[model samples]
Target: MRTGGGSMTTPVHNSPRTLVLSTKTWERELAAELVRLGHSPAKSRYVANKLLKRIVGRAGWQRQAFLVD
Candidate 1:
């Protein structure tokens, strides 16, 4: 998705409070969790992406809050 004229793949500046992981890492961890719970690999990836989207959205909210403070 686009953000401030940049795509989501754009590298963001790192902050102590904003230690963001790579999307692939997030997806891998999420998928592993799902697999442990008996989900198929393909389904796990699909669900992981869905969950990661919401997580990234909330991360933006947190970043806004950080700026406000």
Candidate 2:
């Protein structure tokens, strides 16, 4: 990753769960949720997409807690 003036460009990660939200409400809501979850704003899309994928992806993987209680 390269950084200039304290901001770094994030590279796209390879994820099996990749979702592209089209509805404005969905996009906005997901971005807000991701931010609330502490992800950087710049990475909101990637994080949100990955999350959507997991939600709608083929069912075969074990579930992990996103937040520890």
| TM per candidate | 0.52, 0.41
Global fold similarity of model 2 (TM-score): 0.41
Q: Which residue ranges in model 1 land beyond 4 Å of their true spot?
A: 1-20, 59-69
Pairs that collide, model 1: none
Question: Which regions in candidate 2 have their CA more than 4 angstroms from the true location?
Answer: 1-24, 59-69
Clashes of each: 0, 0
Q: What's the lDDT of the predicted structure labeled candidate 2?
A: 0.50
How far in Å is the alpha carbon of 46 misplaced in model 1? Answer: 1.0
Top lDDT hit: 1
Residue-level lDDT of model 2, residues 1-69, one tens digit each, is: 112322322233544233322333344467778888888999997777676567646564333312111
**What TM-score should be assigned to candidate 1?**
0.52
